[model samples]
Target: METELNVYLSEVTDDGLELSGTLDDSIYGFEDEFLKPFAGLRYELGVLHVGSELLVRGKIEQDFEAACSRCGEDFDFTVKIPDFTASFAVDEKTEFVELTTELRECILLTLPTYPVCREDCPGIEKKEEKAPDSRWDALDDLKKG
Candidate 1:
């Protein structure tokens, strides 16, 4: 299901609002990179309207796909970020607050710099070892003489 990232201030209440759903693919994506979300992000969040600030606390889970740093193979990665929290100042006159960018930043920051296909990936194979050339043997004999 498509999750809307806009939370209207009018809909928020002092008692807090519960948010649980999968974020839309269009909301978070890469332009020309392999690193992307395999499945939309799932969030179980609590949105509280506290005086002048919006306090957001929740858990976010997501499946991601990225090319392996060593082998360049595609692999799946899972992110289960717990205790995710964000606070935004309430603009008294604003009608809505957009969370798409903020949430995207949060998730992207949790990704690894170098992703791997597997824990024990051997990576690229090394070139085969070569035997010592016979020309070197002649030099060794000359040195011995």
Candidate 2:
């Protein structure tokens, strides 16, 4: 599955591997309807090989488009997944591990619950409150008669 991870760990480089690259993929599967990964995924990671398991920690950056929770307006956002980390145990026979799912999940977990376009977003404006229209006065007068 090295094709998915886009990085292969050699049998001899078991001590650790340092990698940095850009991942171009349409990442989806988030519970939030407004948030989506529009820009490419960029990362710089350190992988520590311990036995059959790999311990990974690094930074991930991506651009996103999210709808404002109050006004439903789309806004561009940048997500910085600093210290993004994951661990995996690969089969001894496996050549390389795939990290597509792990990377996608790391970004999804960092999505804002209620995304706002701006700190001072007024949202949808409310209609002005007013007294009853004068046209209803005639009906009230008729009822009194």
Candidate 3:
């Protein structure tokens, strides 16, 4: 889902900009056999005029369901991501590109590589032990002799 940023950008002033929005599951694409749809997201974006540059700051909060990597239990997990970046739009012609890249990178970095259902989840059960090979026993006897 392409989130609308115009509202937030329009509010930008000498002081800063304040933006609020709801992010649905569509934007995140958080799909796993174990994870269910994430709840709606709440976020704020603030843009400030620094000494000679523009600074972007944002915070997002959302909840998602995750399954234990080892076990198969499911649990709810909350993610709150806070990020900031400085842009030199006055001096750099590619300030828009840099800002976009920074935001994307921050979002990716905030996500977890592995979301476990619980910290103490027990992994899958082990299979029953099998009997030792007869050949190994014979080899042992030969060595003893």
Best by TM-score: 1
Deviation in angstroms for 115 in model 2?
1.2
lDDT of 2 by residue, 1-145 (tens): 0224544657327567887776764545443567777657788899888777777889988788889887788898888988998888766676777777788788777878888988877776632356779999999999999
Can you give the TM-score per candidate against the true fold?
Answer: 0.77, 0.71, 0.60
Among all windows of 10 consecutive residues in model 3, the one with the lowest summed lDDT is: 90-99
Best by lDDT: 1
Q: Candidate 1's residue-wise lDDT over 77-107, tens digit each?
A: 8988888898888878868777767777888
Off by over 4 Å in 2: 1-3, 11-15, 29-33, 126-145
The candidates, ranked best first by TM-score, are: 1, 2, 3
Q: List clashing residue pairs in candidate 2.
A: none
Task: Please state the error at residue 103 of candidate 2 in Å.
Answer: 0.4
Clash pairs, model 1 backbone: none
Alpha carbon lDDT of each predicted model: 0.80, 0.75, 0.60
| Residue 126 displacement (Å), model 1 | 6.6
Q: For all candidates, what are the clash counts?
A: 0, 0, 0
* Stretch of 10 with least lDDT, candidate 1: 123-132
Return the number of clashes found in candidate 2: 0
